[model samples]
Target chain A: MTLLSRRHILAAIGAGVAAPSLVRAQSSETLKIGGMLPFSGPASIEGRQIVQGLQFAVAEWNEKGGVLGRKIELVLEDDESNSTKGVTAVRRLIEREKVPFIIGTYASAVAIAASKVAAEYKVPMLSGGSTGAGATDQNTAGDPWFFRSWPDSNAQGDDTAKAIVNKFKKTKVAIIHDNTNYGVTLAEQVTRVVTGVGGQIVSKDGYNAGEQDFSSMLTRLRGLKPDAVYIGGWAGDGANILRQAAEIGLKAQFVGSGSMLSDDFIKLAGSASEGFAVATMFEASTPNPIGKAFAERWRKSHDFDANTFSALGYDSTNIAIEALRRAGKPDGLEVQKMLKDGMKDFPLVQGPAGTTAAFNEKGGVIFPNFIAVIKDGKRRLDV
Target chain B: MDLFLQYVANGVVTGSTYVLVAVGLTLIFGILGVVNFAHGEFYMIGGYVGIVAITMLKLPVLAAIAVVLLAAALVGLVAEAILHKPLKSRDATNSIISSFGLAVALQNAALLVMGPQPQRLNLDVSKIPVLSSLPTDFGPVFLPQQRTLIPLTMVILIGVLYAVLKYTWTGRSLRAMAQHATVARLCGVRVQSVAVVTFMVGSALAGIAGMLMSSIFFVYPVVGNMIALKAFTVVILGGMGNVAGAAVAGLLLGITESLTSAYVANSMRDVVGFVFVILVLLFRPQGLFGKAAERS
Candidate 1:
């Protein structure tokens, strides 16, 4: 140690303290992205898995020296699967946190509600799980910053209708859906597609989510004697409806949306779940290089099996990062423009569903559709 | 006519479930003079307990039900100690507020532990003799073995509870406390003990309902929230503190729901149920079978 004057020592201390921040300030520091997740409600199971995938992606990116020399930071807000709460969460992310990007909302209604706020503030929002048709409709009065990682219900409904008519060879079908934006809209689309294909819809019904008693509904449907029953809802409600239908001895062949193709659905429906078919995006049994690696890493880290939601979440994060890279800066407008211009053909990783994860003009993902059935108490890809 | 019978049968089955949940709530309210708003959470807890018993422990159906009853009773006992006993007043509003908080806490605890996914009990009774042997007429009057079991079990349990309340020493004490808590305490009745028994019995009833329905409706954290509202409606329709009335009204409400769903639109089912409640309140505020307001 050399003795020095007070001014000399002060100058040396200032230099040491200022050097790191100067480098950080020049390199753009850390970029924060907001996440509005349902971490504490009925959809928490899916939300937790989704966040796991997002965190995994962020960690991997940081390990390779983060995008634009700045580590990505995620600011999470719990939407609780409620539309009002989801709006508040998005507002906080935009107004207070000032995050340029947001990904979230397991429920479609919540996503639609939050997107309004995102539109008002001019921030880009990518929904990881919401599949409601309203999430991306250009007709909606909003700034076109809303995009989704999964295909909308209209696409699924059209595919499901095709499967029911062409493959199952069913002409008379009854329909029931959960009374939510996702379920109701999907049912509407399915009805449209079925009628368009000349299939007669004999009966239409709706029930609240979390309702377990479908004895009366089944009894009424049983009287009609339709050739098949189409359920537009998530797995939990679908399983309940299927089990009750079995208990009531309603023998209509059952078909559900892609949301029903999960291990949980199989476990809940049990033997009643046998013969039920679903048209879904992701099938865990499907062999894909990217999906296998993601699953392996997920299982090793989380000590649990990853579902389709997790895979989509991982893919969505990658898409956002790519857009960030293409933008070449942290400005929200630049990033949104870049994504709108080229995200449709961007070469993203192959999803677990074994489809190239590409977006259409409406921010809807374009992927191959596969039909699955619960056979021998497992979700097996049928066609 | 066969379809009519089927609707009736369906109503009875649905009503039996309502009776199990409503009677317990009325009994607790009558004795404790505190509306246990967390009653639904107890029902939810019962479902979870039943799942654990049947799936994890691999217990038989009856044994699983027993475990659920015991566990839910214990939870109710602890809840009474922590939440109810501390309240300075027995006002309905006070109890409602405290129990509502308890309800939120319990639901959140369940979500944290169970991960918000619904789990099934996986108990099927397709081959039971008595249930299978039941006479059925085509599509309408058909009653599965498991569906028949709901009303049968409800009748048996209600009979037992009635006999116990009518004959047992503890039953007399509970009735006496319900009539006049201060007078009973002054007359040497152990108020604390009666309160404990009330919660236990009420919680056990909720547990039994959850266990029985777990096979059909499945088990989840929010499973009881909606059913609890319907049960409350039944309690009010049958007279706020009348157990026998809850049983009768529950069956009536269930039938109404079934008929409404069949003849009217499905969405009109709950609306009709509430309409019945409104009409009952307008005409007979004491409920269909309840006694007129009395002065001590």
Candidate 2:
């Protein structure tokens, strides 16, 4: 009878430990896609929406059999809506989890920070919701590894500014924006567009993201007496500003960026939300077939209506999966090549009817922004 | 002139809320000598309690306020026992670190349970028939019935607190303890009970501020963070333990922020508080209303 020695036993155990990993590498049973989102910080709500959309798309794909004959698995990391946290999360996802592709990040600052890490690792990353101009602009001058499914701040600002000046015909405008990358960049874009269109900007100001008090700012705006007030902030702060504006009797045609296109804004603002116009990509009232299908499916699962965040997340995932299918392997460079070469007239859930997302040379998509106004607490398409 | 008055009105409204939060902080710091970094959690707790009372329990506005007070006081008692009491004999930094940890834990707990959605406590005075018909517009200044309640409530609360501190035997004991804990203990003052009472009162005030402000501003987990910083600034600018100084400083800070936003720039509003604190620390380190530093 043959007996094993101590060295042999140790070697056998080591082999046993290394065998499973080798098998895993060979088989590649599931393709893991990393998602970095702010699940706990100030932008947690948006993160939840984006995750929901991503989950829905993944579930649908799995039902039909995932890409490359393998079931798709999502490994998520919470960025906490912070840039530093975002960098750490992305590094962990790329280095530890070894995910070839990454999707994320609702906050613009986080997206910008995380995308640089993805570029450093040569892993293609797609942003579902971040709209800051810097997110794409910084990448364009570099490796161009980051792709955005959502419209950048410049597109939304330009469209909204045009509507405010030409459609609403309000020449004197006041801009109040949150001091984040998203708000600040959008405000700049709006300023550029408004001035280019010969509209006058009377007052411009920025506030912190979670700032609740806008009484002084509103009063100052009232003194300036701008015909229209453009708010470039998220739903929560926007609602507070609107409520305070109404309380202090600062009456003007209130306009906002796409971030205000959520039910939370209307519910929080209550009657103050009436007649508030915003530039948006996805509205629940859209007649687009893909959007309608997504909305119907989303409503069946969630108690709330589908908004732009979810739509963008769904489109971003589909684009990533499509690129994966084209690549025929879970390889970062190949997938990125497929994305750059193949993504054209890509069907999207966001933007106007018949609008499709296509990446520019800068790896950015410019979807047409539709102006929607809150009439009786419902967002109705205005222009 | 009208614009200036409007700015003042805005500042006063903002200041009243700050006063409510700052007074409680000063009371706790003055009496207990604990920095109480988690003081803001009590405010956040009060806001959540308000949501439960008004929205879920369907209580009236007055009843909701009472509920918030009771809940906050209970929480304060728990915090005193678990967080502050054991660390009472330790160095101040230990307590500060522990309290900071408690703040993070409580914030995460709230986030886990409530799911980070901004909730509004519906205290719409416009819904009441009598108040609805009242003129909301005062010439060029528009004072909504709801906003008018903020300063009025602050005044009433501060007055009652003053009267209680001035007349009651419990107040004398608390004052003695604040003046000198060893002497007060020797003179038959129950330092432990007084400390508990101080926490309860301080936490209750902060909670009430949260409840009142939640009606105007939406209630969320992190809602207390910004206000707590302002309250700290108020505490420092007023002299750390001086209650009256906190009240006046709160108003001054609020007005300064308002005028800064109005005249200088809106982005500069928050910068005004830190700049004032720095200037005050440089010139009058003892604070505007504080006497010469007493060597504890």
**Model 1 global lDDT (CA atoms, 0 to 1):** 0.77
lDDT tens readout by residue for model 1, B75-143: 879877865677726556887888887777777677666757888766656444455577544454777
Q: Which portions of model 2 show Cα errors greater than 4 Å?
A: A1-28, A140-143, B126-140, B293-296
What DockQ would you assign to candidate 2?
Answer: 0.43
Q: Each model's TM-score, in the order given? A: 0.88, 0.92
Give per-residue CA lDDT, model 2, range A100-161, as digits (tens): 88888888888888888888888888995888777888876424688887677887888999
Alpha-carbon error at B117 in model 2, in Å?
A: 2.0
Chain B, candidate 2: TM-score:
0.95
Residue-by-residue lDDT tens digits, candidate 2, B1-296: 88777788778888998898899889888988988888888889898998889889988777888999999999888878866689889888988898887787777677766757888888757555555676767777677777777777899999999888889989888888888899999999999999899889988999998887888888788778888899999999999889899999999988888898988988899999999899989999889999976676
lDDT of each: 0.77, 0.82
Clash number by candidate, in order: 1, 0
Candidate 1: stretches off by over 4 Å: A1-30, A95-98, A138-143, A285-307, A348-361, B88-90, B124-141, B294-296
Q: Which of the numbered candidates is closest to the native, going by highest lDDT?
A: 2
